[model samples]
Target: MGNSPRPGLWALEKSTDYGKSFKPWMYFSDSTHIKDISIGGRCMCNGHADTCDPADPNADSNILYDAGVDEKHQSLDIYGRYEGGGVCQNCQHNTEGINCNKCQPTFYRPSGKRWDEIDVCQQESGRCECRKEFNPPNCDSCAYGYFDYPNCKPCTCNLNGTEGQHCTPTDGICPCKYNYAGQSCEICEDGYYSAQCKNCNCDTSGTEPSICDDVTGQCICKLLHGGTRAGACVRALRVRPRRLDRRQLLGRRQVQLPHQLWRQAVQPPNFDSVKCDRCREQFYNYPACEECNCDPRGVVASFAGCGSVPAGELCQCKDRVQGRICNDCKPLFWNMQEYNPYGCEECRCHLAGTLGGLGACDTRSGQCECKSHVGARTCDQCRDGFYRLQGDNVFGCTRDCDKQSGQCRCHSRVEGRRCDRPIRAHYVPTLHQYQFELEDGVTQSGPVRYRNNEDTFPGYSWKGYVLFSMLQNEVINVVQIPKSSLYRLVLKYMNPLPDNVRATVIITPESVVDIQQK
Candidate 1:
């Protein structure tokens, strides 16, 4: 307070309740300044309500008086300036204590300062450049995916192909999507599958070109589908390609007409060669050249040239090869050319009898040249004492019969000078000199022997009693036939006596030897 209209006085604490209520905080005088009222003291002045007066709170503090002013005597001469509470002098409205060392509201002390600097607080950016999370206002704590100090750095999640605005808080790592590999999800590896990157299924043995389609992973079909659809000659139908034709226009060099040249289906793009491939009429397209349908042995020759070669002018065959297609044999097989299926049978030439082992039979006559005694178209016959069982040219003769002499030739199974002896035991009369034993130790002493039932052998057994009817000396002269000649034995059995004996005689095959019994 500086001026006043009346003479009055100001008071200090003058607490109404000992020291509780600090009210009536006005000057006791008139015309007081808020600054002086804020400072409590015994300040007094003189003047009417309309005249001059020290109306400030400081008018109560007499210790704060001017030396030339006095309130009660209305004099200019005042005294008593020495006092204890002078620090609040000229204190601003915002200040509190005896000293004006503090600032007003909305202001604070700046942290970290020297003692010389006033401790008064000041207005700031509402932040000390902190809080990366907040935007323009006060800098509070940082947001989720951001780290703050002075700079608001976005969380870069290690570039591992992660998505979204916020990366993992702990490590800044991110998750990747499907089928995408590498750090940035930038690459699709392998091949395209289901619209996604996948591995290829390439055949190890039959992979063609590069084995796989670099994009879709569907097997790549290079070439004009000429090879297998999958590059292998499997049984499935192949994927056909658009064929290029002459009329399609390319100056005409090659062709792939269906059956024209079945042998060379893949024609040369240039037709300047001296020769052009052509298949026979019977030939069909099977990737490679196939042989004619006619019999190879009968088809003497063939011509091929897009059917330009007349059928009538086909390769001519000899008369021997007779047929519409020259696929037949002519003349008798024995005398004709060596042909297959329509040719002659092999000549049955006996080793010793046929043309002195030359085996050169008469082809014209189909006659086999035989030895002296052997008589047959094949020269494989034998005499009475010998026989030819069956014939096989691989062996020396027909079975065991000698071809030249028409005689029995011993096989390994039998033994004898003439192969007439059965080494095991003769069960038949087939041998010249072999016996069938009816029983062992067979005599007239047993009833079984007398009844002809000693034991029936494989063949008939002989057991008989002999008797001589002549009572006088009958010395019969008999001739013994030699082994060199053929012979037979004749026997006669009759009455049985103790002294008299019956004899059976052996004679030549002509019955020349005589016999006498007594």
Candidate 2:
């Protein structure tokens, strides 16, 4: 066929006869008579052509030369001899091809083209396989008490008598260094004990017995009770005696004793020490009798015959007197002169002005003369700011003033026997009327003005003494005292002046005359 269409770019051509049918076709070299079609640019067969020039033989050969195609794929032939399907290198079924499926069974594949070597699969056993010591089977590492090599290994005992595989056991059974006891060697030497053999008994007088090791002769003592010597028992001393009962002895009736005369059969006579007729139960001796003094303040009475005495024998005090003989006067009442039978004949204070004095009452004076405010025989007076109002009664004096006018007014606001406080302002007469004269000889009758806004006085401010009668409407002028310039304020009235008069005057410092007149 037209020198066999160039290899890779081959196409079937129509036959010369119109009735002929086509066949599955590929290209072959015309002179060599060999099929030369490539699949993926790989050469299918090895054959040479006669008409192909040596320099550029089979210019369109099936062998691809493009760098984009793989070196292995450049020689692959589509219609060449067939090779059986190959398996992946990673799989058990894989024989001779690149492992296209790189993962083992139950594993995922890795990204990349298949290669000759295969990759291992990840574990999918579903059970944990790590080997920790305390961890269960297949654990990757050993737990705390166990060490791990390829497999888990347990700890070995530290020494003999140690049972646990672990280095530390619940009870450290190894014996203590020396002189120690108990499972952990917590106690020490025989009777003495502690974490170590550090203490011993030293107290010798205590109640408990001390101990010593049988072999070493070292002192050991019981807890809290210790002694210096070994096996020495200490006893406690100083015990108190029980109380004795005495109630039964006091309840006995009259006790009697028998007198023993000389008898044919001689025998020792029993004698009772507590048989006394006069002294009763308390007195043990019989020869002397003691009297019981019932008075708490008196001395006990004892005699040769009586066992006890009653309270009547003690001396008593009379009205104003006290003591064993009832001779001294009572506290507040003092005695001045000597007196008998009646004790202090007249109870009195030390001073003349107080109560009863040394002698009888002063019938002439009626009562003792007390100093101004003082009372009684002592001359005691009322406290400061106080005065006596009634006769000799010290309780009557008061600090109040008399109620009537013209009396020394205790206070302008108060008007009573006792100036306890101010009287109501509304009750006092705030204004008063009078006659007065002026400096220019003018006269007037008016009310005088008081500093308290409520009080007023009607009068003038000139020369002369003006006499105004409160009862009769009379105003008369009298001689004025030159020194008392205020006399000028009196007045000679013009219009039968009103009953009350009031006036206002201004005085300057330089106007000595005006001020004096006011």
Candidate 3:
């Protein structure tokens, strides 16, 4: 019998003649007086189940235990007399309680859903519903472990060596760690050693060959030198090695003997050497070993270590100077003796007119390199036939231009300093003629023919040049005046007639004037 109460209507019947006829003897109703009997006399299945069955004694009672919950339910059976069962089946609305009264584990009944409806429960679709370390909406991909599709076999990765907790799903390979290598980032890379993977830091000069022990990170020091980092060679003196400071061990290959050792090694019995206070000429101040002073304008500031007085080592000089003192100018510079602030003046040869176009020139005379055809003192101007002096051109100019003014000759319709554009025709917007031409109002009468010659005529001449022959030929032109104003007219002509022959000109309408030409 099940531990929980059973839910069913109960009635007693007496049978006679061995399963033939039966008579009703007792019926337990809602008002019946029974001890510990619950009201309603039915299973508590909410609205999902319509009926309930009695407990089967041979059945596994563990199936009735929902997640280990065994709370008693209200029913019509007597308490503690017999275990009542409310085992419900044929659940609806996606509910899956033992009594068919609750939503399935993977689904939920949304707010405002009716109990009997088939869609009362819905599956959770949000990615946040997945496991904490799982990936994707369905949680099918594994992170920080090997993949098995919706499941994972966890494998640890080195936090210091790997960029993230995630590993390659196929091979479970973690990324390389800082200064570490291998599939799982388990060991240090070359030149580094130990669990912490520190650099060897071997001394480059004091050690025979700068390499350290792979495990201990210890360097091999040369003779007269010692220490993990390979200390400098020490000089023989009365003072013990322990007196030398750690700072005295590092730096350049050669250093002056320590002051303690100098005094012990060279001081006389009278101790007069103790009075010596001045630094040697090679240094500005001794003991501290300060470098010699150099002219800032002449030498590179970063390399100002000038050697001894009579020229021992040449200090690095600025762009256009030389000599140990950096006082002299280079071959390409001039006027160094004047003590110019910038050392010397660079000969700025014009690149266009320079022989090799490289700005090479004479240093002493300040003469710039010049091409054979470039004769100017500065080599900036082009010769007689060339124009448009430019740096990119081979001869510093394009040829074929007017020799006197260096102006290029262009076609009649083209106009520009370089003859690269077309001349636009002029238009009078207020004029009555729809399309006006140069010969618009001119009338050529009797043996006169029209001709056009743009090259032979001046640019402002109308319709180019026109010719007329014979004495009876005549040309008449009409003019329109937009406003009253003083005007001048000039006519140019070429006639084959004798020099003594006379020609008559006439102007009429609105103050006409006539003149005779011979």
Candidate 4:
């Protein structure tokens, strides 16, 4: 039954053919006595009341409120299918859906809990309350481990080296330690001088070692010591009573010598000198003092030694000097020679086109990185539009010419540096038409042509320049076109050039083009 016409009256209705033919069920009620069902709407229930265990209000044992529940939309009963009517009144706690059997999110039954009283994962004050560390989305894992969950474990890490979010429980390997580097925190940093890289014991003494082990604090002797430490040198014993052995007659000259020295010179351990740092240059005791091979002007001198040290000393290069021997100066800086008045002077760079305008050149090869309108080492030669004059400045080109500008500057008869205007012409995107006065006072204009042989030759004009040219190649008009489009070039020569003359037609370098001639 849905609703009655009278304000507070209703009747039970029945449908004979799937709600087509209806009749009353013989019962009626006031709107206040029972829930009012709409004339055509299905019945539905309100929220389920918590009544499974009234003695324990907080305890979970709730069931659905089934009075007005829609059987078609919700479960029928507590132990029946889950999709017939609304949950019954006094439904169980932590139970959802129509039947009240499904567990709520983050809630699971403990070993001893009843079926209606499933336990919540995180409980507080006898209610399903999630802890701050773990979200309800997933109770399996947590960060900054302080407590363990059923799905997650507690983290283990040393606070000094790692703590909180830095801990990796899966790999069990600390990302990095306080002072140590590498996988296991075993090696020192690149400036492996000391523990904190604060102190360097190398070269502290007269013959101080140049390098040392970072961890062991041991001196690494230079190669001159035969890759050995200072302690590797052996001690020698002195012998007395020298005598000559088996002297040969050399023009009756007396060459007698000590017997001990004569036998030792030809026997085992024929030594010449002992390894001593104090005997070397600085005269101060050192770890390893090898003999000095340093040039007076190319090395630093401050300490002395009596032990074995490196013979190969580091050299300080002189001004404008290159190489360990200081034989040559660097590029762009001259005043070469072994000894020059000007130390190493930077090359004088001029404003105007100095050959290729390369500031300086290589000292050895005299090669320069060329610039615009300039090339060659000296930068004293003009590339184009520059006349070669007797006196050349740093720019090299003394007089401007037609090379760069293409403005011919030769005699009227020739009109171009290479006599190319009247007899020969060059084609470029900028040039559109060229008219010349003939001998008989008649003007003969070059052919009008389009660049890249565009489709506009018949009716179209590129920037107002026609595509038809009287003399082929006379007026070259190069242009910029998209690469993907086809290159269509149609040449119609209205006048033929004399056998002796030829025009220069140039296209962009490295461009691939095709001619679609009609």
Worst 10 residues of 1 by lDDT: 43-52
TM-score, cand. 4: 0.21
How much is 334 displaced in model 3, in angstroms? 3.3
Q: Write the per-residue lDDT of candidate 2 for residues 277-296, one digit (tens) a residue.
A: 33344432333332332222
Q: Model 4, range 346-382, lDDT digits (tens) per residue?
A: 6554424434334554555544444444655555455
Model 1 score (lDDT): 0.40
Question: What are the lDDT figures for the candidates, one per model?
Answer: 0.40, 0.36, 0.54, 0.41
Candidate 3 error regions (>4 Å) = 1-319, 323-328, 375-378, 400-518
- lDDT tens digits, residue span 1-518, model 1: 56855456766555778888776555565555554333223321211111123245445542333333332332221143423233233433333322333545665545453322434334432323334454422354445555443454666533333455344544545455554444534444333222244545544344444444443344543343322222221122233435534442111112334224223122322222224354434443332333344445544334333123334333334444544444444322234343434333445566565433644444455556565446667666653343442333322234445557655666666766577767785433434453323233222333223234324322234653212234321223224335453335433233334776544433324444643222
Best by lDDT: 3
TM-score of 3: 0.19
User: Which residue runs does candidate 1 get wrong by more than 4 Å?
Assistant: 1-296, 299-320, 323-326, 329-507, 511-518
lDDT score at residue 472, model 4, on the 0-100 scale: 34
lDDT by residue (1-518, candidate 3, tens digit) is 57966445568899977979999888766554554422123345545666553244244442322222233542222232213444455566778665564788878765566755667777642213345557633466775554444556555655456666456666666887567667677666654555555675776476545344445555655668767652211222354343555455432223343544432233212222344354455554334434454545577545636543334454667677776567556644665543455567876667778665655444456666566556465578777766667777666766766667866788688777677777888332333332223344455443335557655454534555555457435666556656554445445665545776565666565554634323
Instruction: Specify the poorest-scoring 10-residue window by lDDT in model 2.
Output: 248-257
